[model samples]
Target: MDGDRRIAAEIIEAVGGKENIVSAAHCATRLRIMVKDKEQIDQSKVEHIEKVKGAFFNSGQYQVILGTGTVNKIYEEVIKLGVESSSKGEQTKEAAKSGSVFQRAIRSFGDVFVPIIPALVATGLFMGVRGLVMQEKILSLFGITPDHVPDNFILFTQVLTDTAFIFLPALVAWSTFRVFGGSPIIGLVLGLMLVSPSLPNAWEVAGGQAEVIKFFGFIPVVGYQGSVLPAFIAGIVGAKLEQQIRKRVPDTFDLIVTPFLTLLVMIFLALFIIGPIFHSVEEVMLHATVAVLEWPFGISGFIIGFLNQMIVITGVHHVFNLLEIQLLEKFGNNPYNAIVTCSVAAQGGAALAVGLKTKSKKLKALALPSSLSALLGITEPAIFGVNLRYFKPFVMGLIGGGVGGFFASIFGLKGTGMAITVIPGTLLYLNGQIVLYLLVNLIAIAVAFILTWLFGFHDKMLKNQE
Candidate 1:
């Protein structure tokens, strides 16, 4: 406990003391802090702090990398020290107001999907496990024929794997509602209605197995299974509508009337208006993404891979969630995940070079763990803490990422799931493509490491530190 307090004190002092801080929050592994004065931050001092892995200014926040579990502890201690804590939604809203149009759109997409990624990631892992267990080689090793597998076991896995994607709209809507300050339960119910059993399944309609329902003899509607945009749009409308209704409804009956009217009006709008229009828009976006990936000579892959980490730096990488989800829904696989993994690996590689070349023990300590963390598929530590601090290393990483993405595109490598990458990404390729995936990552890491080692860092900084 004393150690925690001390570390917390160091963080507070490094970020320019308590008065400079507006709000602080924590994600899976970062302590995201929004401070009033960015210039007051001591980047070098923060990075050298004990228990601090890396730190960077992203979007509108000064994000400190404290790694998983440790971040939560430090977050609590910081709060105890009189630094006000803000909800993630509030932080996002503050950050969202300042970016360019495209950037703001990307940030909005991130806001909607960030809260829902845990469910998707859990589902993806479950799918990977199911794939591994169902593989012929695994079955043979277990001396079990395909027909001999237990029926209940298969059913259980199916239930676990399919629940998230099957009802993804509800998850999106629930999250969007919360982000927009609406009642999450109402948002969830509205989302559930979009994919209700009463409506024909979306895939069935897509496959021509079931017909779309014609409402009032003209309105065409179908279940929104695996749809993201519609739920996102509907959530916004529902939240706004709920807010408006609450303003008019008397306090005595506010609870019942607010929910009833919000759902009643929003569901109709979702079914008749938002669903069909955005569904078409989603299709166009999906098709456009496919076209970009299919561009000749791997140009598309090179571009995407090179710019991937740049997007992460701006804190807009979560926008890719929509594209990946749509890709998996339409194609049953996501190549984007494969391509982006290269970018992540390259960042790790660059960080590794920095770790090895730097003479300063403090810089070495920061670089190594950040590199390892990036290799594990989370690159914030490596990016914010090491590579970006030394500008050359980051550019070297982009070059390596581009080269790796080009090769992956040429070879057409893809993963079986979305959301997991780098080391844990191996789970997605367990159905016989693991070697190809590993080779791609190796090439990416090697290229970035060599380029960074040769040209990325200057010894002058190390000399100064010494």
Candidate 2:
């Protein structure tokens, strides 16, 4: 705890002291601070702080990357030090004003999806495990034929693997409500109503085994299992509507009346209106995405790979979680994840080259740790701390990533899930594709390392760091 306080104090001082801070908030991996005077900040000092993996200015905020759990602790400590803090939604709104319309949309999508990735990652791992155990060769090696496997065990695994996607609407709506400053519980209830068992199952309807019910003989409704966009759109509407209603209701009756009315209206809008409209939009998006990914000669994969880490640097890469989830839901696997993993590996490779070639002890220290971290599927340390600073290495990493992405797509390599990548990502390829997965990563790392070592860094750059 004392350590946290010291780090927080250091961070506060480094970012031009608490007096210069306009507002502070944190997301999953960063301490985002809006400062009254950017000129007062010493970026070098902040980057060198203990436990700070990297730091950069983006969208008018100085974002100090502290990875996942550590950022939350540092944020709490900052709050304790008399610095005024904004709610996530308020901070998001403030930050959104600095970006273009497209960038803001990406940031909003990140806000919604970042909170729910853990659930999707867990479900993906569960699916991998289920796949592993159900493999015919594995079953035979264990002397347990597929026919001999327990039905109850299969059912249990199915439940584990299916729950998150099956109830995706609730998760999306709940997170979206939180992002939009609404009552998360009310958002959850509205989302639950969208996928209630009482409604016809979306999959069953698609399979032509079930029919949608007509509400009052005019409004047709169906369950929203596996849907994403509708729940997100409904969450915004619900939150805004609830806020407006709160203004009119007396404080004494506000809590009770606001929730009841919000849910009543939101649920109606979600089921009969938002669900149908966005479901079609989602279908179009899904089709478009598939078409792009399946484009000839892996051109789409190369572009996505090259630019993926750039997206990460901007903190908008979390938006891809929605696409990954949608892909997994529709096709039961994610080729996008496989392609992106190569991009991640390329970043690590470039960072490793920097680490190996740099003569300055400080540059060596930063590059090595950041490279290892990137290899483990986290890239901010490598990108923000080492590669981006060097400029050439970052570009080399992108080129390497593009090359790797091309090969991955050419091979049609895919993981069983979304989220996890690089070394740990091997778990997702456990069902007979592990070897191919490893090969793709090796190709990415090798290409990136060779490129960066040859052209990306110089001793003069390290001297500058000194």
Candidate 3:
């Protein structure tokens, strides 16, 4: 058999074969398996598989890490190996993960925002290219001048870079409706209403170029272009309303009644209630995050960097997505991403130091690839499989991250976008800001690498650790 097949076969054997598997699914970085018997699993054998970076049980599922792009392939081979997929299985998997109300809520936010990141990233790259081509210094470096740039080309770049953010409410609402089990088409329509041209534009209103229309003498209303919270809340309410309406209306009228009722009720609530309320809520949140980011002399950066990876361990880091989106929506760039990147770089650095100094070949094998993975963008393999397993290296990485984040705050670094980070994250800094970005990562990585090398690991501890 080929590598995927071989890996699938081994996973099947290790997990007590297909007969014992209740169901199996794959996410971005892991193969999640629900088994009939946990005790039957030889987890050590699963971990030793060639591409699996780590293995663990969580949320009542056995999660095997195979990194992004590989998990799906391995999952396919596993399915072909007689562990069939079932709707019940998929349902059970989702149901199993619906932990507390807070967890489900946070996970919902993650699911909604994760789909939207690629668009933002593409937009950020377009902005980077635009900034690069129009820069006097960069153009002079290429023996070209700014006057050589065409007016139409700059306009074209604006379209590429601005469309996603301008219509962000539509995207967020569409995603929220999908998550909340509403008609996504209705969600899209509702989102569009929030940004309708008939209403005063949000940016114009902010800049005092337009005024909010007061309906019923007290309700202040303006377009919700580029808004986050309003759209998100609208999606949830609209979806829930649609579901409730569908149940009450006859099937004959359901198609017309459900959507009509959802839109009619949602449009009013969204414009007058949600828009007015949550927009202010979002502003409050924005101000609070600003306070933290601007906290005296980089103190906030140091604290966030030190504690961020520790937050990752608890798996609630998705909450930051809302804050980041708010920051970008208000400020046009994200300073939070810069500080977070330093923390991530530190993790990779600590893992690299451990890989270099460890005597055991297994330690060397696991540490090196996981370190590379952390540097590229994903850090679970590095955290769970290597650094956290060693303990001290994780602490050293945290300290390094803190130190780097302090510098990031001092430098006032901001990224063009979110999602991509560390090495691939260079795209976010390409708008005449790459140098400072590089310096932050270098400082974080160097600090973590040096600290871990000097005091973090020992070969003797390997005998006691998993």
Candidate 4:
């Protein structure tokens, strides 16, 4: 397998050539590629390639699973092609190539970031849980106290969970430039433009608190740190520029001239023009969300809660994560985002109820652990293994989610930077008018359990599978 580069190349060629590859990136177990035309891609040929373990398509992406250690090398080779292919044939080879780089960088960053989710989630939940434990004096047995809460380990975990967001643009730029066929040094410069200290203050200027700042009394650009669209859009433009410059420059000058020109142009474009325009739009949107959430709590909570489950199912849940992070960083807290907790709880409760009601021992076994994991806010097992298998449980979970979400909305309950935890921890936001969030979560759990138990557990469909 180490000697076999042809397998990957053959698959790429079969898919329609380097040009057909609109973008290419890899995850831990899969190579995620987007191509210009589905019809031109030979699925059979891709599957038949040696060491190609599997092939499938989801969400417009062509996924090819390969053996270990092969994908990274293969991805590097693909990025080297420096050509873009598009469905309309409207985009340039550089643009097409850059598009792949941009998309794949997102995917690759996701690959790196996703593996840490469980630990990050666990740490986040533990923060809430730890607070609860201290509140209840539950840690007396371990000689723990309120002061003990801020230990080095806890501080370390806090940094770890936050590291992704704080350094996100750097990570994105590093991955993006690599995927787009540019030098990492250029990516570092691009990354700097986003995370620069000067930019955040520029937002204050944009909002009318201050005036623009100049570098060497000439350059002027707004801030874009922690902004997703700006650095990403800049990177796309930068990669294209790199491709164009690399092609025209003599081989001797290519090494020094190409990256220098790419970085110079990208920084100017990002700082002086595109970055500010895009960043301003996001700031406006943020203001809009802030104003909207100030409305009747019920409406905001209901919609957010309802859409949360749907978005996660579609694997666009990261968008929510991004939003939540942004809101917390800029505005202190987000009031309308209570569904993640309830949905996780509902999923678990529904699965547990099904487990209890099921006559099939196998289903009971499956549901038991899934429900427990779901309780811990890990719902993939529950969603895929049990709820998705038996339709009613999933529907019940959604219904419970919607109803609970509605109540949470009514209460105006919002989480204050606590990591997601079990069902009960999410109820921490309930106080007076917000108490409904707690009550509704319990009701949602009960409803999910009872309804799934009644209609789902003993269903003949699941029994037959067992």
Q: Which one wins on TM-score?
A: 3
Candidate 4: where is the Cα deviation over 4 Å? 1-168, 178-185, 197-210, 214-220, 291-297, 334-337, 416-441, 463-466
Instruction: Tell me the whole-model lDDT of each prediction, alpha carbons only.
Output: 0.87, 0.88, 0.87, 0.63
Q: Number of clashing residue pairs in every model?
A: 0, 0, 0, 7
Task: Order the candidates by lDDT, highest first.
Answer: 2, 1, 3, 4
Q: What would the per-residue lDDT of candidate 2 be over residues 355-389, giving only the tens digit for each residue?
A: 99988676787788888888899888899988898
All-Cα superposition RMSD per candidate? 2.7, 3.2, 2.4, 9.7
lDDT of 2: 0.88
Q: Score every model by TM-score.
A: 0.91, 0.89, 0.93, 0.62
For candidate 3, the per-residue lDDT at 291 reads: 91
Candidates 1 and 3, the one with greater TM-score:
3
Tens digits of lDDT, candidate 3, 303-344 = 998999999877678889889877777777888888999899
lDDT tens readout by residue for model 1, 231-349: 99999989989999999999999988999999999999999999999999999999999999999898987998899999887766787889998887677678898899999999999
TM-score pick, better of 3 and 4: 3
Which stretches of model 2 miss by more than 4 angstroms? 1-14, 22-34, 44-53, 66-104, 214-219, 464-466
| Model 4 agreement with the true structure over 310-410: per-residue lDDT tens digits | 66765545544545545754643445456557766777889889888778675677677778777766676577667866677888887667667777656
Superposition error at 284 for model 1 (Å): 0.7
Could you tell me how far off, in angstroms, the CA of residue 213 lies in candidate 3 after the best superposition? 0.1
